[model samples]
Structure formats: C-alpha cells, structure tokens
Target: MAAEIRLSPCLNDNFGYLVHDASTGATAAIDAPDAAPIRDTLQREGWTLTDILLTHHHGDHVGGVAALKEAYGCRVVAPHDRTAALPLVDLRVAQGDVVKVGSLLARVLETPGHTLDHVVYVFDDDKVVFTGDTLFSLGCGRLFEGSYPMMWDSLLKLRALPDDMLMYCGHEYTAANVKFALTIEPTNPALLARAAEVTELRSAGQPTIPVRLGVEKSANVFLRADDPAVAAGVRLKGADPIAVFTELRERKNKF
Candidate 1:
C-alpha cells in the first residue's frame, strides 16, 4: 500500500509532514520544524512516530528533532555530511542509499544547493517526493552554502524526475514565488493560470503544495533556465543556461 501523508503547519510558513505506511503501521516525520505541532498531529491521527527524516541542518527544519526523538524514541535518519551539525542521528544516509520506513522505501538524492548537506527523499513506489528546501512549487531555495552552478545542477537532478510525481516542499512560499515569476514571464499562460489558482488557494487559507511536478516543469521560471523564451525575458537571449540561471536567481533575490 502507498504511504499516507499528513501535512502539518509549523513555525509560520514551515511545513512538517508525516508519512505513514498502512501495511505495517509505520510512520515517519519528514522534517520536524516544531515538536508541538507534529506531536499534536500524531495524537490527532493516532499514529506512532517511528522515524524522523532530516533533510538538512537548518534550524527551521530540524529544530524539533531533539524534542521529538526524546518523546517518541524515533530513529533519526540524517544526511551523511559531517559538516552539518544535525541532532541525534541514528542513521546517516547519502546519495543512492535507500531508507526504509516499514514497507515503503525512500531513495535518497543529495541536492546540495540551499545547503551543502541538503537531500530530498524520493518514494518511487508512492510517486511522492519530499523536497525539504530544495525544490519548491515555483521557486528554488536561496544559495546559502553552495554556488549558483551547484544549485542549478541540483535542480536539474530533480527536473529529471518523472512528470507525474507529486512534490511536497518544506515551506509555503508559492504566492510570493508566483509574483516574482510573473515579472520574468508575464505572458506565459501556464504561469498566469497558476497565479490565479495560487491567489484563490491562499485566499481560502489552503496549502499550495503537493503540486504536480509536471506543472512545475512548465510554470516554474527557475526550472526553465534553458528555455529560449525565459532567457529572452531576462534580456539574455543567447546567454549560457548557467548565466541565465544566475541572472534569474539574482533578480529573485532582490524581488
């Protein structure tokens, strides 16, 4: 059976996810931003927390790891990067390694851009990907420890995934991301439609995540750095894709 997922809001815009395998009654929290919210959700759902998957060492992402671990004694699986100061990891994983949460398996993909130790979990059998702070709905995370090229390559790795996959990111920044996207590709119908959808979702106090990766492949300006139209929109028509990507990132930083 596919893993059932629960989305919980944590610390303003951060998101905490619970991945449950029904067959074995095993549940894993994607990243614990806050223990109170995650604990409350677990109690409400009546699910025992067996695992805590750490994407990176960011405070907003792993702030509640210690508390959750202490409460539930759940195994903490973190990236193998020793430089990242993560908390109480029971298992350290890296690229190509598969972490099992009961019967469900999550393939680890190291996407070091937002942070050097960042990794996203891809559950191929369930067609779901937990993109912590790597690939957002319409925007990518800012380059804090990695270079532009490094981030771009990391994004491409995600872009290569099957279009049918559903993406669950770490934060709810789609509204602002769509606004900045419009400045680059105002005439794009996909972007326009997505903007409208986002506006309505936000107004209704809904989360704009678990979005189709196919939709992002077309509508996300950051993912279209190689497209001629996007290059032209940024006034670097014939520039290299890296150059275009760099320009776009710089502009979005200011936006």
Candidate 2:
C-alpha cells in the first residue's frame, strides 16, 4: 500500500507534516508547530489523527501535541530525552526503534544537533523521511545544544541513506539556505541550478520542501563537507571531513 503525505505551513516559517497509511487509514502529524493547521488539515481530509510523532522537544515542535491529543485521542511518540516539558509520550523511542504508522513502518535515527533530543523518521518503503529541524534543503539546522562532532555524526547518518529518499524537513528555509550555500560553494553548477529553481518556486508562492535527497546530496554544503571544492571554498583544502564540516557550519552560522 502506498503512503500519503500532506505538507502545511505552521507558525511563521515552520512546516507541519500529515502522513497517512492508505491501507489502514492511520494518520499522523509529524510535528505540531501550531494546532489550527494540523487540526484543520485532518478535519478537511476527514482522516483521524492516530499519532503525533515528535522529532525534538522544542516548543515549536511539541506545542500542539496536547491540544491535538485532546481533540483526537492520538498516541504520541517522541525521543527519550528532555521530554518532561512535552505532553505525556505514549512511546519514547530511542535510536533504531521501528515505529508503526498504520501499515507503514518508520525507523528512527537519533540525530541530535539542532537540539539534544532530535530524531528523524525514515519510512524506507515509502522513500520518505521526516527530518524535523535536523537537515533542511541545501542546509542543516543550527547547533543549539549539540556540538560540531555530534552534528557531523548525525549528518553522516542521513548521508548514508538511499539517494532516492524524499526529505521533508521542519521549516521553510530553502531560499535562505541556498543563498548561504552559494557563499560556500559558489562554483557548483548543481547548487546554482537548484538555487535558481528554489528562487522561482518561492516567487510563485509555492512551498519548496519535501526536497529530493539526491539533489541535496550533491548541492547541500553541509552534506558535501568532504568535497575538495567545498573544502577549498572554506580555505581548508586538506582538512579532515569533520574539520571541514565544522568550518562550514561555523561559516554558515555567521553567513
């Protein structure tokens, strides 16, 4: 059976995802930046919310869990740390746990960089991943709690995934991310083409999310830290991948 996904904008720039398993009608909201959109999306589609899957403990991500649970009686799944501030978690998953979203199964990858409790969901059969603030199109999340090494390791986990995976991140920062990426590897034609496409998409008032991982694998600066061209751009020509990644991330933070 195929899985269905719905993308909606929440808060000012954050994104909310609604995924459903067609065979079982098991619907889930990946993260609840705001309740109104998630609530309305489920209502508008007439799909019962069965689960609220959290990627981190950030308020923007978990803020709507309580209201949605009260409205739909959905079970909540989240990482097993810093969850005291979140609503009661029905399942506290660690790395390598398989979560059933209806008939679909999602494997959890603990990716702590933006936040200490960050995790991304990979539904292998569906060729989709829900990356809540871990990785974005042409960029990665800002380091707020974890260190450069931790974030670097987390990114490698994402990099090793199949190239066909479609990434659905937590925010609408593609245009900005692409801009900063150009400063890192301005000579990359793939990045240039992608940036142009993103510019056009945003100009048309379209959402530039659920980006292709294949494209990101080549264009995202954070994901290409080992590339000689990228290392050269940062003036770290023969540096280690971790060091290059560290420099790239710091440059982006200041970019």
lDDT agreement with native, every candidate: 0.94, 0.90
Return the clash pairs for model 2, or none: none
- For residues 206-226, write the lDDT of model 2, one tens digit per residue: 999887799999999899888
Top-scoring candidate (TM-score): 1
Best by the lDDT measure: 1
lDDT of 1 by residue, 1-255 (tens): 389999999999999999999889899999999999999999999999999999999999999999999999999999999989999999999999999999999999999989999999999999999999988989999999999999999999999999999999999999999989999999999898889999999999999988989999999999999999999999999999999999999999999
Question: What TM-score does each of the candidates earn?
Answer: 0.99, 0.97
| Model 2 ranges off by over 4 Å | 82-84
Cα displacement (angstroms), candidate 1, residue 217, comes to: 0.3
